[model samples]
Target: MERFTSGAHEFLIPMVFYSLFCLVLTVNVAGAVSIQDDCHERRCNNHEPPVRFPFRLQDQQPPHCGYPHPGFQLSCSENKQTLLKLPRSMKLLVKRIDYDARWINLYDPSRCLWRQLLDLNLSTFPFVDEIEPAASYTLLNCSSQDEALYKGNRVDCLSTSASQIIAFRSDGYAYLDNLLNCSMIGNISAPISPYFFRFRLKWNKPDCGDCEAQGKGCRLKTNSTEDQTECFYIPKHRISVRERLMIAGIVLGSLILAMIFIAVGWRYYSEKKKKEGLLKIEMFLEDYRAFKPSRYSFADVKRITNHFKDKLGQGGYGTVFKGRLSTDILVAVKVLNNFKGNGEEFINEVGSMGRIHHVNVARLVGFCADGYDRALVYEYLPNESLEKFIFAARGKDRSLSWERLHDIALGVAKGIEYLHQGCEQRILHFDIKPHNILLDHNFTPKISDFGLAKLCSKDQSSISMTTARGTMGYIAPEVLSRNFGNVSYKSDVYSFGMLLLEMVGGRKNIDDTVENTSQVYFPEWAYNCLDKGEELGIRIEDEEQTETAKKLTIVGLWCIQWYPVDRPSMKDVVQMLEGDLHVLTMPPNPFASTDPTKMGATIPRKPVNRELPTIPEIE
Candidate 1:
């Protein structure tokens, strides 16, 4: 019994000390909380500074909460804005209040603080501007056209439409003596800041500076005492050494525990994600073994591209870099921006480019899928994209001759043709804009950027699409709306048509900056010129160039027919490009019948199966 009692005493002594320590801490916290709760800080809104002792909300706080003065009392406006109304009812928003600094920041709620300053009387207010000293400014009404008037010193708000109100500094009156048609209105004495955006004011009475300096808060000695303020130690503001040690120990212990939990969770999650990524990569590699394009690691890609030092271009999907494979071979590396985007873009580019081997279609050299990083490598064309050449400023070095442009158009058509028919499964190049058309050193155009490509069987005429794809101007009407027709290979024809028109016009199809308003929509305007037998408005040096422009314009109009079924197939387009310009007739004015009711009137009631025309194939 004695031994048991001794053991109980040993345990009870420590328990008693712990209970006392907890009690003391609780009391200290409760005391601090109670002091704050007695005259709690109030705010008009979340953005405004808290109003407390030395400054209090008029209706919200009691009379004993703040200094006994009109300036110390702030009010919440109807709009929930903290407002400090001056002597003349000029309300200024209370932006911030620093009890320690003994300063209050204010700005005119009306935006023009200078207008208020012109007639401000600060004698009644408890605050005075220590930063901005009082100065005299002469107001002058000057003529609007007076060149001698200092325009920078003019008050735009006070001036009329016909005249400028110049607030000339009194000390600099020598420069304003020669002003034309200027009359001095009056002189006003006011505190002026450099830029009257914010007004800062300091106070002397109910001084809490000493208490704040000593790390204590000041309160009235008694509720009735207006003149006397006594310093009181705020436990939260000035914590004891014992409390600091206790808080530090608790924080340190919590942090160590949290760190251990986080480390374990992160390790488990990382291993799981790593395993899943490896499995995905293995499956991707397995599917591409037969195609056998080189697979590069992220490190290898960085090495090949010189740490992404030389950038070629950027698009919505990724940034392309100029890279070298060897001494002689150069490649363009496209580092995808969102490699985790359902893995659609990366899959589309690789899968679509993997099967094809065409002279006009850009060749994929390799790809990278190391960890989170993904990139596609392609053969680098020295001339960049067709956009640089066609859409460039006039007289630049990248401008191509009409003949070269015609050839490029033909090459692009062939590339699209191969995408529609040449492959085992027809590939649809959804995005076929000038930016996607890359040109080699010899100016041969190649279709690139198949990020939006879709695959369907050769026999399938139309495919189901839930959402619209491709650049805005180049997207087919059918793709945007089913009323035009079902989307199919014909959509590519429409995009190619838009591309063709852009190439011919040396501008986009929907150019708004053209001098003639009628010519703003280039395709519509080009058709009007073609229909009227007028020379295309573009600069044409010779008859041959005019004929080339007409041919491309006519083909573009035909391809962009509102109804997909009304548009020609890629094969027909290829033949049309290779054939004589005179043989091609203007397509049934596609833009003429825009109304839903008149659509069938101009368009064919049914898609007529036109006999395919043959032309000599390009070698």
Candidate 2:
């Protein structure tokens, strides 16, 4: 009895103690999640906003601040850049993170895109490169270029320096020497041009769109493996597979019919909107009507425009006719063409303009989308566009006063500011040149033309754009190449900066007639002037107007800074323009070329003091 008690009691006592310790540990771990606030917002650098639990900077963040261990960890470099370490020895220098959209833009700091591409192991990492082309080429760093083996195009870099990576189509892949050299195939990427030092990165995360709609911040659902995120205030959406299948079928059938009708009606009239104008868009917009008002019929449009007689102007889309809505009200009826490419122009105007209303923004009074006919009715500005004023014959009497131009700039800034923040949805007018700015009888500038507008949530970090938008001179660097930066409202800000510079110099940014090579790009010229305190010798009406020109030039320089991070927001732009001119300082040059010249630059070479003096006419 004594022996049995000694062995059994000792074993049972120790086991019970161990079990109790395990229970307490599990409970404490669960409590750690339940007891704390959902987000601990942290800003890694000035360029990025406050990041939370899912993304934590290494060494800087406490343990349990972000994900516990391996996943979602980032390291800060000496330059204050956040580094994303991927599996299989790949590193990405993070430029910015859109926490709401869960999109991250990265690049190789060394400016060697080829090295990063060669080391990539896509299967090992969760990131997806959507902005880049789906195609990639294999580069063989050889002792010498063999005439026979060199089937692919030899990348011409900055004269002496050439790209090691050779671009080869699948047809040319067979010509490469596989056995003679160490052939390394790059991963998914853009064309084998000069390295631009940028890549777009995206990660798969739980959908928090609904959660944000419920006004709750997203959090990692504690102790979960898959579908680990949840909105703090709202339950996660879950539906059975059968229900999902049924819903998919219904959406598909509806889309198919709508696409067919829109395709058939392509030859009719309505201006612009190429890709987004697929008839299937009505499904999304119908619910959005709560965000809009009444829709006008094609007959009403014809009647309003007096049978399309009073023509105001004509663009790539269609003709704008000035019409009288009533004796007291005048309207601009823009009639679009039939099918151009897609119907993005029609979709852009009605979808975006109808939802927005501001003193600075042109009011979308009504619209006509009758089959094969689309027309947008807007408040008429008797003074026409800011174009006639800013580009007013250099010295003609029609040229606007400097004070009035200042007011127009401020008004446009406020309008863009409202578009970016005041509304329920942030609208990015990819085209923000002077042409899109209409002046009322009182010279109050109203932003018009939603033909290239994009709607995004106010909190979203970035929005994806499939194709480039806007006129040539006003297009931002990032809009054409993702390597410059992610596309956001900042793209519009860049355009605005160019517009202001044009106002100061009284010339188009890309004008070849300018005698000075540095002045060809108006923004760069303006920067040089302000940087050196050289007075912009424009036709000034009054002595005080010089101060106004200085202020606009300084703000324009700041807005047109090469990187999006260096540019101010529309909100900030308004404040700067409204503030004292003496306090404003010059910004870094916007035309400073970071990468080597690409293969096909047509501009003549001149030794300019600044960088990229002439804008490359990239298609």
Please report the candidate that would top lDDT against the real structure.
1
Task: List the candidate 2 regions with Cα displacement exceeding 4 Å.
Answer: 1-293, 338-352, 515-518, 593-619
What lDDT does each candidate get?
A: 0.79, 0.69
TM-score of each: 0.49, 0.49
Please give, for residues 1-619, the per-residue lDDT of candidate 2 as tens digits. Answer: 4564476466557655655655565565445435344445666677754566567777776755565435478887677767777655557677776665666777776676555555343444445566653444555543344533553454333112322445454335665444265354444343322245676666666455566556676766777776477767543445558655655654565566456446534522232344347554874576456436457888888888889898999887778998987899899988877445445556664766676767799888778777778777888999999888767777576788888889999999999999999877778888898888998989899999886677777777577777898898778777787666677788999899889988888877666676656555555555566767786767776769888988888898888765676789998999999899877766755554422222112221322222211121111
lDDT of 1 at 434: 93
lDDT of candidate 2?
A: 0.69
Worst 10 residues of 2 by lDDT: 610-619
